[model samples]
Target: MTDATAGGPREVPPEQLHLLTEFVGRSRWFGGKGRPFQVVGVRRLGRLPACADDGPEVAIDLATVGFEDAQEGSGESGQDYYQLPLAFYTEPQDRLEHAFVGHFEDSDFGVRYVYDALHDRLAMGCWLRSFVDQPEGPLRFHRIPGHELDLDTHSTLFSGEQSNSSVAFGEDSLLKVFRRITPGANPDVSIHEVLTRAGSDHVAALFGWVDTPALRQEGQTEDQVLTLAMLQQFLRTASDGWDLALASIRNLYAEADLHADEVGGDFAGEAARLGEALASVHRTLAEEFPTEDRTADQLAELAEGMRRRLDAAVEVVEGLAPHADRVRGVFDALAGLDGVQVQQVHGDLHLGQTLRTVRGWKIVDFEGEPAKPLAERLLPDSPWRDVAGMLRSFDYAPHVVERSWGDDEGAQQRAYRATEWATRNKRAFLDAYVGRELTPAEQTLLDAYVADKAVYETVYETRNRPTWVGIPLEAVARIGES
Candidate 1:
């Protein structure tokens, strides 16, 4: 925990402080969970310079702390430091939106506070200074009437396991405040920059960004995600790909007595259309960007990495061994192929990462796997990795729904129907994708890519989410049997 104050600061009342601490712990945005946490300390960053008529001067800053016990209460821990950046607004009844108050209680001295470190003006100002000079470029700031600005400050939290905090503004603009900041230009910003420059309509438009020059810490550069605010034409009636798929699955299950082709709410059409959109996007990427032939060494490296991941997964779920071997065979077969095209691709593609609007299916978020190192995500790879990711997502929808509905007979029936729906749409999508005439080499490459993706999922699910691991394990088995 880095201190933002010049020197040490004072503390609040024990009851007020405890209320604040408890309030923070209950928040959905708060990352620290399953661990005992005490304030350890708090420092008021500074007053938010009175806006008008001597209103509340919002103070903000970081905090430092130590665990009560090293290894007993919270499983395991040492002197762990945390970045407890916060914003305190005195106009609790007026300025505070009380975003998550319904989810958590705040008693007396209940000043409205939000974990707004990501989009803090200071942070964004810092980030912006690095790329462009102040008062120019994409990082422009001006003082508007406080009342006018207040009306425009509508904040709604995005729902998902996000790597950062995002709040949409007026449906036309989006601000993605990165959580775990890295020094380099983030790929999400970088890729959107290219796509927008290329006049690509398939992706959200990139208006601009804010960044700051980082300080040199030890031998490394330290940069934070001040703010990556982008303006785009928001889809007014757009449905996320996950919702669309879930709806389709539910509809199909409801009409399971009818043939999928004859079903009223069939997803085949959407799937085919999405497939076409993806193909178009891929073609554009290939045309605008350079690609290279995947060398044997590169393939070997991928194989080794995949093997290690699979081995770890198998250790966790012994039931996965048979499926793992089959998935391995697919990779082994692909390794023999020559001249596979390698290019930059969406390293993490899934239903949640797409949107279906009046314009059609538009891919969103190009940040790649959040857990992977930046270098690995930026690396050029087979486009099939993306394809496999989508396919796996398709498989997850029904299984997830089934789990949600419980493991009763009714749930199994719904799962079965959903699987049928998924299979039908998957074929439809693949047909649209493969229908594009391709060289035999391209076909081989695509197959290998899909195999690699399934293997990746197998490892990921097994490690982080044991319950969902079976879905990818099943995919590996099916791919092998095929």
Candidate 2:
């Protein structure tokens, strides 16, 4: 165990370090699952202030994992930090058996049982109260001056998330605790802050955030900040956009004779609304943040990067080899464009990132792509990239549903209907977003972006879900043929 400061915060015992490593390995939010790593150090950042006497003591610990083999020139030290908020009790609680992390003997408190604090309502309540109170400590909680928090609500941890753990407090607020720790300002927090302050209705309003001084380590710079979590308004009556799309696909499939628009669950209307919401958010981001133009030469560099990625992808996804020439042609056309306008965009946008509520469509998770570095995720990109992601997601919706029905009868008919559904929704979304027919230049950019996204999906599906690899391959074939 290691100390974060020279004299502040206590260190975990050396014997207990393995418990943390095992715990992290079991967690869904831990990103370095497949990689070989060791929990080299643990440092207590601070304790959550203000808890009832009956409640367990809640403390935040930072665990540093060191990787044996580093990716050369990847700008990574091959090490990572994870935020662990633990609730310690004098005795093991039967109710928290599922959330238990092992027991350890403390210097001052003696033997204490630890559990993941986010799962403990009482511990989470302390967190919500601390955000409202903004007490003095190394863990600083900042709040925006709008909504009053309800202290009596219980926190329920969301199970759907992969990279971060989100706990919803009643139906009022949601706290997103980032598991993988990066030392700089998080784009998710910064982007939400801007949109929330601007009164943009497309995003959940940001209430506040949790942060502290960066955990200083060997070969790392000091004086930087680390954002641990963010508090935001919870959409109590919202439906996931991805779920809605799948339902629409299922609805279309049930009535084989009905056209996509004639079906009860036709999603073109909702798709149009989501497109408009994204456009509004993009406009807001472009106005609030900086905007720049990529010259023809820079666009050539972008096209070249796509080609390089395609080259690498071919090695992993052998099916991509046949479509390589056509995909390359699409990317090469991008370099012929005079210039393209760029702005701060949702680095990764898709049906899964959206929610439909009573008010309208709300986009969430502005943290960009999980695979990229924080700096790369924060870079300004053409809004077409987001548009392309959504378009590919539209393509994915019905195909994903169809893939679920393997080797079934009437497969050919379902394939035709699926194409019809995808085409209708994609057209509706694109038309609503641009408000007109796409010009030649615009078409070129959108086509290239869509092709690039499809290439990425091919690589992902090849590694994770081989059966679904055909979805992206089909899209690539269509793009190549066009």
Best of the candidates, TM-score? 2
Alpha-carbon RMSD, each predicted model: 6.8, 2.3
How many clashes does the backbone of model 1 have?
Answer: 6
Q: Which candidate is the best by lDDT?
A: 2
Candidate 2 lDDT tens digits, 1-482: 22235213356666788888888889999888788887887767777764787898888888888877778797766888899999989888999998889999755347899999989998999999998777677788999989999888999999995689999999999999999988778999999999999999999999999988846645865756788999999999899999999999999999988999999999999999998999999999999998888999999999999999999999999778888998899899998887688988998899999999999999999999877778888888999999999999999999989877877787988999999999999999999999988899889999999999999889999999998899998998888575
| Tens digit per residue, CA lDDT, model 1, 1-482 | 22233223445556645655665565565545666776555444232222334222223332333445556665454332223334433444333344322212223226444434333443322322222222432223222111121223344446667656665554645556554443455677767777777877677766565443322223654533322333334555678888877776666667757756776777789888878877777777777667888777777676667667667767766577766667677667666666667777878888888888887788888888865656677777778777777777777886776666656657666756767766887788877876866565565555556666666666677667878876766666777564
TM-score of predicted structure 2: 0.96
lDDT (CA) per prediction: 0.58, 0.88
Deviation from truth (RMSD, Å), model 1:
6.8
**Cand. 2 Cα-lDDT:** 0.88
